[model samples]
Every structure is written in C-alpha cells, then in structure tokens.
Target: MDHVIKTLTPAARPPEAPGEVPAAPLRARPSRAEAEAAVRVLLGYIGDDPDREGLVDTPRRVVSAYDELFGGYHENPGEVLERTFSEIGTYDDIVLVRDIPFASHCEHHMMPFVGRAHVGYLPVERVVGLSKIARLIDIFAKRLQTQERLSSMIVTEIDTVLKPRGVAVMLEAEHTCMSMRGVQKAGSRTITTQFTGVFRDDPKEQFRFVSLVRNGIG
Candidate 1:
C-alpha cells in the first residue's frame, strides 16, 4: 500500500490536454542488420569478444528481442477503441477493468517497469469491449515510456476515442532502473493515477473510483 508517487520527468508537458500537438511519427532509424551491427559494437565496447562462438549470435538475438520490446511504435491506441457497442440498457455507471498487468521500458534508461493497471470509465452512451481495454493497455505498454506519460496517454486515448463521460487510471509499477541499478532500491514501487471529467470534478465519484481500484480500501 506504500509507494512513491512522483513524475519521473517533471518539466515535460503531460501527454494529455486539449490542443496538445500529436507526437510526430518516429522516422525509421536503423535496419535490423544495422541494429545488429550496433549491438555487436556495444558488445565489443564492453570488452566482450563479439566473434566468440558463444557470443556470435547475440547481436541477432538482441535485435529480435528489441522488435518485441519496442513494438508499441506500430500500434494505434485510437484504433483499438473504435470497436465498441452501445447496447447496455440503462447501465451507465462505472465500468472498470482492474489488475491489467503490463510491462514497459523506461525511456530514460531503456530498462523495464512492470505493473498492473486499473482503468475505469463512466460511460456516456457507448462502451468498448472489456478485452479492448486490456489491449489498449498493451499497445501503450509496448513503447518506451515514462510512467507519467504512459498513464496520461492511456486516459487520453480512452477519453478521446471512446468519448467516455470520465476516465480514471491508476498504475503501480516497479522500475528496474531503480531496482537493478541507479539507487538500487529493490522492491520500491511507484504509484500514479489520473482522472478527467467527472472523476476529476466530483470528489465522491473520485473516492468511489479510488475505493474500487483499491478494492474497497479506505
């Protein structure tokens, strides 16, 4: 129940907010062969024998691993929410999908932060599929991210595409950068939450959401 709650990057603008400029498409940087070459260079720089029989294929493996690690670049969050249904009859209260587990790379160190997400939205008229919420989380999680940016991006994507009456997101993650290196505080976790519309404007609604996310905890 105890965790750190601070933005990893303070000066950068939040990923949400009306009129925020869309992120420019990232240009192609290196081909797989080029990436493998770079990995080989790194192995050499680290004083490893790149051509040693045991290490010769490492560069190729690393490149293949990166393709999966950073695949969020190819995903469009809006598209995932496009499949929705409005068939819920008079069921317009909070729709929550909790304990959605995910992993993401920290943009600063390219290390991993693993966590579970709690996402909830007050429906206006339309509601997206439950699995779509999990898939939405996955799409964003596959990218290099700061937890701050990641949480905002999730809420923004749901609100923008689903036209939800409100959105609430809570993410609790353990950053490997802190646990494996840097300060090296293993087991330290980070908790972050964001809200928009009714979840932000109404305290009772916010409290209800928090309680639900924490599973009725006060």
Candidate 2:
C-alpha cells in the first residue's frame, strides 16, 4: 500500500534586497479544526486510535503544542534589535554573550536540535541589550531551521541592525533526527559558525572570538 504525503510548495518570490533576511512566503493557512483533523490523520498513520479515550484529545493537544513550538513564524526579526544605546564612551571592542541555550526543529525532519549559541560583535557606535541577543536567537530557533542557516541569519541580523565592525556566531547542537533515527548515534554533537566584517577579514580577530567562546576570556 503506497501512501502519499502532501506538501506545500511556495510560489516563486522576487529577489530580496542586499543584507535582507528572506522571510517565509505567505500561504493560505488551514483553520484550527482542519489542523486538528490533520493531526488525527497523523495519529492514524502511526497506527494509533486517535478516537480512543486516551487519545481523544491528542489532536487538540498536538495542535496547541505546535502553535507554541513554531511561534517564531509570526515574529519579526527586524524588530528584535530595534533599540540601541550609544552612551558608552570609546568602549569599542568585542561584546560576546556565550552559552545561549536554544532548541529548534530541523527543517528536513522537524525533529528537535537542542544547542547553545555563542554570539559576539564589535560595536561601532551603538549596542543593543544583551538580553535582545537571546531573544533574537529564540525568534529564529522557534522556526524550522538548519544550524548553518540559523547561524547565518543571526549574524546577518546583527550586522544589519548594529552595523557592527564584525559579527560572530557559533552553534553547537545535538540533532535528534540523527540520534533518534538515522544511525542512532546518540550523544553526537554538530557545530556551525558564521563570521562577517573583521571576524571574516582578520584571522586574529576570528581566533580571538573562538578562543573567547572556548576559554571564556579575551
């Protein structure tokens, strides 16, 4: 018995402006009842009795969980770093926030990849709140993502918003899709990084960022 899984194909989009992070294309959304119906279908596909007393509300619960898990789709990354402060006098160096814990679903499998992000930037004239970096990470992590793309998105947003002299981003994660399924190699971790401006241009600065992230010192 061959079963087909339906997927949504987004229409072609125009080219994005330089330095702009491309957003997910808009598509017609299904109603809550329709979403729950699909969840029931998934439960049936897994050979479970979705209508059983123990599972009767599973569809509703799953739908509600998904709403919370994928809430990033409704957020705007541009707004995350909107507020900046420039009061620091002549303090122009790397500002790093390491060990920012995050959880994201892999775009391919929708399985979770739990990780920590290390972000740093060389402030030019202004700086954003340290907490905003963590919030920015959450905004991107709550969406379907690849570690590489997620790293790039974070760097780009910081560079665009802060116009920093450099930006650095590193992500270390254990992808459940790999450990829980293929090869079943549990406890394996993946690392990804992105650099721009001085971080990309100078090996010394890049090494400093890496060393700082690893050693927790300049």
TM-score of each: 0.88, 0.89
State the weakest 10-residue window (summed lDDT) of model 2.
Answer: 1-10
Cα RMSD (Å) between model 1 and the true structure?
8.3
lDDT of 1 by residue, 1-218 (tens): 12223332322322433335777654556677888999999999999999999999999999889878876666556666776787899999999899999999999989999999999999988888899899878878887899998899889888888778899999999999999998999999999999999999999988999898887553
Best by the TM-score measure: 2
For model 2, residues 1-218, the per-residue Cα lDDT tens digits are 12232232323332232365786876667778999999999999999998899999998999899989987766667676888888989999999999999999999999999999999999988889999899989988988989988898889888887899999999999999999998999999999999999999999999999999999876
Query: What local lDDT does model 1 show for residue 18?
Result: 33
| Residue 196 alpha-carbon offset, candidate 1, angstroms | 0.4
- Against the true structure, candidate 1 has what lDDT? 0.84
User: Judged by lDDT, which candidate is best?
Assistant: 2
Which runs in model 2 stand beyond 4 Å of their true positions?
Answer: 1-25
lDDT of all predictions: 0.84, 0.87
